[model samples]
Target chain A: MDNKVHLITEQDIHAYIDGELSGERKAAVEVFLAERDLPLERAARYLRNNFDLKAVRDEVYRDEKLKSEIDRLLARRKPRRHLIGASA
Target chain B: MTNQANTISTEDLNACLPALYRFAYTLTRNDDRASDLVQDCVERCLRKQHLFDGQNLRSWMFTVCRRVFLNQIRRDKVRGVAVDMEDAPQSKLSISAFQEEKMHYQDVVESFRELPHNDKVVLSLVAIEGLKYEEAAELLEVPVGTVRSRLSRARSRLRDLLENSGEEGTVVAASV
Candidate 1:
């Protein structure tokens, strides 16, 4: 994150998005990013991808219809090889 | 049955269902296909229960899911499934009014499916699935550095993809 002397590298961007950068270093990265538009958007989106994906996944899991469908499939699918638990 | 429980029961399989389906979805990028792949993987696990080392059921299930996906891909190729455009998504995704966030979820996940298989695997495991770098590396049988590097590259590539597709998305927010 020490971009004070050198240009912002991909490593700094990674740390910033992961929230590993802090204090002055974090601010410096922000300063470098604020001057640009696309890079900032990309960085923000990258950070949010983690959050967005988790939110979407939670939404999927919370869907009662999908859950019921999967449950029905499980109940209906005959265990042609249902020997594991029985043998054990 | 010790803590490892060499025999994987229906209860164990049930507990692992969500995680397995999630992993399968990351690979197949289709709901029904992912579900079918999970079922196939479950069958393989049950049939090969003696092969289960009895440690980390989720991890083992993930491995099985990935193998099943590969096998399906091979089968599809042999069966002459429709060839997909290298960079073209299977469906047109656009941003519509009042559902920006919902559309965005499809946008992101759809773009994710377009990424190289390795990138999708690494990013899903670490970012979406919440595996540590070492754990992902071990699961993937790659070095920790490789995982970190692939994750970085994957993050950038995913961003690029979303950016590329977002431009095509219809901006219908003004009416709202």
Candidate 2:
């Protein structure tokens, strides 16, 4: 399993996972992945779990207490009133 | 009926506040600190309303918030405030179920947090904020090539770290 990673260059793996490289490079990685015993599923799982930052964003959004504080702050900043009577 | 032209309104801010909070949370990785950061940024933006062109409200707010956070970091440096990555409290979830999964997630976050601050900023901007590479490059004020290199380094390092180590040990310190 140690040498299974030798099938793809690190940069090409990155490009493959990121959907960056295309045409020949893309096909090259796909062909490489097909023959390796590196557990492509596990590699993909690692990438997916590690990169899913939207989950973090959702956690931050879930905090209702924080939402209230932001709401309060926004309320206090309700813009200054216009001066209607002074036209020099 | 509300006129959008007269002044900044609560509705506009209300819509903006969530994104601001999310960005601040990603930047600071601490809920309370991120909230404070967002509050400060919004207040500053409101005070300088003339600077806003209404051309791209979201990007403008992001620029303002990012500036405010960076300014705070700079000021904290003058006061000698040390931001220790190792000090972030571990999640309190019981490790009884899916212990490996929980550990892996923690390891990833720690590894990410360990990256240089600039790297973290770009990673979060693209990965978390869902910005295009071009948009992230613009946000970081760097060339697209620089963005690609940093992101490539960051993701590869993360993969290597995850693939080569104990499941429970903290790599955040080493990665940073």
Candidate 3:
């Protein structure tokens, strides 16, 4: 809770939150983020807006036509997996 | 021999049309050309279905579509056709001014389009298609490091574009 601005860089914050940092580096980033003015909510927001792929997920799933088309194509290529009853 | 192969390949083409068309659109940025390119790829894929294995069908179709488009670009250099817009239908462009200004989404799309084809492909594979770097690397026949670098640059470029498009600090944070 020291009011001093955190020495940790934004990249450190990102890496720490994303579990990219490890051991002492991870602990140091956590402490620094806690001390800095950047709140937990802000940190969460930063990760979401910058790192999440939700936007693209929506984009890909938006058009029913596209999904159906892709599924159709994939179904066509599906190999006949013979599992049971070979002589049926 | 030909009939069974043709039927199977036609089904494959029908199923893969959306992804193929979208991939083509991503490459060319022009809907009609994308459609034509995808059609050409489907035809080629149908003809060559014997070469395809059942694994990674999406990746195979994407590879074929991309190669076909590039091939057309090569051929068009020698025998140019009229670039008419009336006959072929266009993509459903999400480029409304209000929408663009409101969310800067159109700005992002344009910035993506402005990037080099390789960059665009890398970005779309990661950002849009949600493929892991390894998967994307396999699809693009590039190293995983290459995909990561491309994605980093593409994300930085997108941020720059959004900032420049007068939508700084307005990025909607994901809730989940």
Candidate 4:
């Protein structure tokens, strides 16, 4: 391991929090966060924000009225079928 | 309609409705406009069902929603109708009525709404919708690098917003 300090980029920190970093880079991020409080707090905030946003989306997704409305709208667009001998 | 065109089942389309709506809401930031966008997209999906390749219905619907939104933006621009981002409340209830946790969540949502449109979409895709960078790129018809960069910038901006909102120290202290 290189004893020199590595400056953690915002991208790297985010990728680390997002689990996009791998192998050596992941380990490096872990080390960097272990020694820092601010970035770690920022990472925690990011995670918290992600969770909160997903909660809001979940509430939106479960709106029964919206679901029924979408269903009704799609139902109205179904192809019209005609009888074989029906006049124009 | 062609006899040999692929078609997606209504059930599958319905299943993807919530996600589609969420994406639309993130883009338009208005309930009525988001509903219109979703309805239009669904109408097109039904009308163009035969054209679907049937690989990823969710992604296809998302692509449709995004295209519809972009087209609407163009038309609105030509007609001089600006889509106001701050016209609607972020949530239905008053923030004061909620407990501390819920208030925090609402604050986050408010801050999220303040982000740029592109940032909101990118963050919604990767952060809220849990889409991989590659998957989001494909849905947005952009390169993977673009998604990554947008997500980074969005995250940084969100952090700044949250911090400036005066909740950063509280959030950190609470977590600690």
Q: Rate the local accuracy (lDDT) of all candidates.
A: 0.60, 0.53, 0.49, 0.62
DockQ of each: 0.07, 0.06, 0.03, 0.09
Per residue, candidate 2 scores C-alpha lDDT tens digits across B118-167 of 55555555565545465556555679878778877776666566566464
Query: B164, model 4: CA deviation in Å?
Result: 3.4
In candidate 1, what are the lDDT values of residues A1-88, reduced to their tens digit? Answer: 2325637776676666554566666656665654444565455456557755554554443545544543443344333354334321
Model 4 deviation from native, Cα RMSD in Å: 19.7
Order of candidate numbers by TM-score, starting with the best:
4, 1, 2, 3
lDDT of 3 by residue, B34-56 (tens): 66787788778778777765533
Candidate 4 off by > 4 Å: A1-7, A59-88, B1-98, B168-176
Provide the TM-score of the second chain in candidate 2: 0.52
Q: What overall lDDT, based on C-alpha atoms, would model 3 receive against the true structure?
A: 0.49
TM-score per prediction, in order, is 0.43, 0.39, 0.34, 0.48
Question: How close to the true structure is residue B91 of candidate 3, measured as C-alpha lDDT?
Answer: 27
Per-residue accuracy of model 1 over B1-176 as CA lDDT, tens digit each: 45556688788789878756655654443455567888899999989887876655665665566567657656654543322333123322122222343556678767776777678667666665655565566666789778778989988888788778763334323213
Error of 1 at B81 (Å): 38
DockQ: which is higher, 1 or 4?
4
What range of 10 consecutive residues in model 3 chain B has the weakest lDDT sum?
A: B80-89
Deviating ranges (above 4 Å) for candidate 3 = A1-88, B1-102, B169-176
DockQ (C-alpha) of model 1? 0.07
Largest lDDT belongs to which candidate?
4
Q: Which tens-of-lDDT digit does each residue in B1-176 have in candidate 4? A: 33433887788888878766666655554455667889999999999887776555665666566568658766654543432223214432122222334556566777777787678777776776665565567667789888778988998898788778875345323322
Which pairs in model 4 have colliding backbones?
A: none
Select the stronger candidate by TM-score from 1 and 2: 1
